[model samples]
Target: MNIAQLSGRGVEITDPLREYVDEKLSRLDRFHDQITSARVTLTVRDVKNAARRNRVEVQINVPNGIIRAEESNADMYAAIDKASDVLERQLRKFKTKFLKQRHEAQPQPEPGPAEQAAQLGEEDGEVQPEIVRQKRFELRPMTPQDAVFQMEALGHDFYVFKNMGTDSCGVVYRRKDGHYGLIEPK
Candidate 1:
C-alpha cells in the first residue's frame, strides 16, 4: 500500500501522529490488497463544537474506483480510528462485489434468431428499463463555496461545477448532518 500523500490542515502533524496514521492505514492492506494508493488529510477546525473540530479524511484508490471515509471527533486519534473502521467495511463490501462479478459465469455466444425469439417469449422473462428522462445544462466554472450556494439556491442536494482553482470537475453536496462536502478527482 503506497501512501501517496499525507498532509495536515490548520495544524502541524507531529512525528508520532504521522507514524500512528501510517500504522493504522498500513493495516488496511489486509482488507483490499489492490489498493493502489492512499491519501490522508488531518484537519483541525476552529469550530464552536469541539467534538466535531478534529477531522480525518482518507481516500484510497482501488482498481476501478476510489473509497473514501471521513470522521471527526474531539481527539485526532479517535477520528482516525473511526475513519479506518469505515474504510475497512467499505473495502470488504467492494471486495465481495468484485469477487462475485469475477466468478460469475461468462456469456455464451450469440443465440440464433429462433432461440432469441423463444427466449423472449418466456412467460417469466424480465425486460431492462430505458431512460425515462434526460436534461442538459451548462456547467459554469466556480469556487466550491459558490457551488454550495448555487446548490442551495436551486434547492438541490448536490451541484456540479468546474473548479476554478484546479480547473477540474467538482461536486458539492449537502451531507446528512447539514454540513457540505466536496468531491473532486485526484
Candidate 2:
C-alpha cells in the first residue's frame, strides 16, 4: 500500500493528525485482504464559489479503478468520517459488481456456416474479395509522457508504443478531463 498527501498551501497537518489519518485508513485492510495496493491522496481545495464551506478530498486508487470521496463540514473530523464512509461504500460496490460479473461469464455460440457465408457476400450476389490493404508503422521506445504527447500531436486519443522503462508495449491516452492515463501489460 502507498499513501501520499498534499494539502493546500494554507492547510497545516501536525504529526499527530497524520498518525490519526493513517490509523483510520489502515482499517481498509479489514474489508479487502487481496487488495494489492492502496494509494491514499489527500488534497485541500478552496471553493471560490463558497467561501464558508470546508473542502477536503480523499482519493483512493486500487487495482480496478479509482474511488474518490470528498466531503465538507465545519469540523475536519466530521469531514474525514464522511469521506471514509464514502470510500467504504465505493469499495463495497466494486466488490458486488465483480462477483456479479463473474457469475455471468458464459461463452457465446459462433455463427453458423449459412449465416457466415451470407454475411461475407452482398445483397446483389457479389462475393467480397479479401486482402484489401496492408500498412505498417514504426514504433519508437519512449516514456509514457512522451507517448501521450505524440498521440496528441497526431490527433489521436490513444497511442501504443514500446515502454522504455519496463520493456513492454504500453498504451497512453488522454482522459476526458485533459489529464493523461496509461495502461501497461502485466
lDDT of each: 0.76, 0.59
Question: Candidate 2 residues 42-103, lDDT tens each?
Answer: 44556677654555576664443345677787666667777777767766766665467558
Off by over 4 Å in 2: 6-8, 34-52, 106-186
Clashes of 2: 0
Looking at model 1, residue 98 earns an lDDT score of: 61
Overall local distance difference test of candidate 1: 0.76
What is the C-alpha RMSD, rounded to one decimal, of candidate 2?
Answer: 15.1
| lDDT value for model 2 | 0.59
In terms of lDDT, the poorest run of 10 residues in model 2 is 109-118
Residue 31 CA error for candidate 1 (Å)? 1.3
Q: Can you write out model 1's per-residue Cα lDDT over 84-154, one digit (the tens) per residue?
A: 88888878877776677569764232212211223223555477767999966557766676577556544
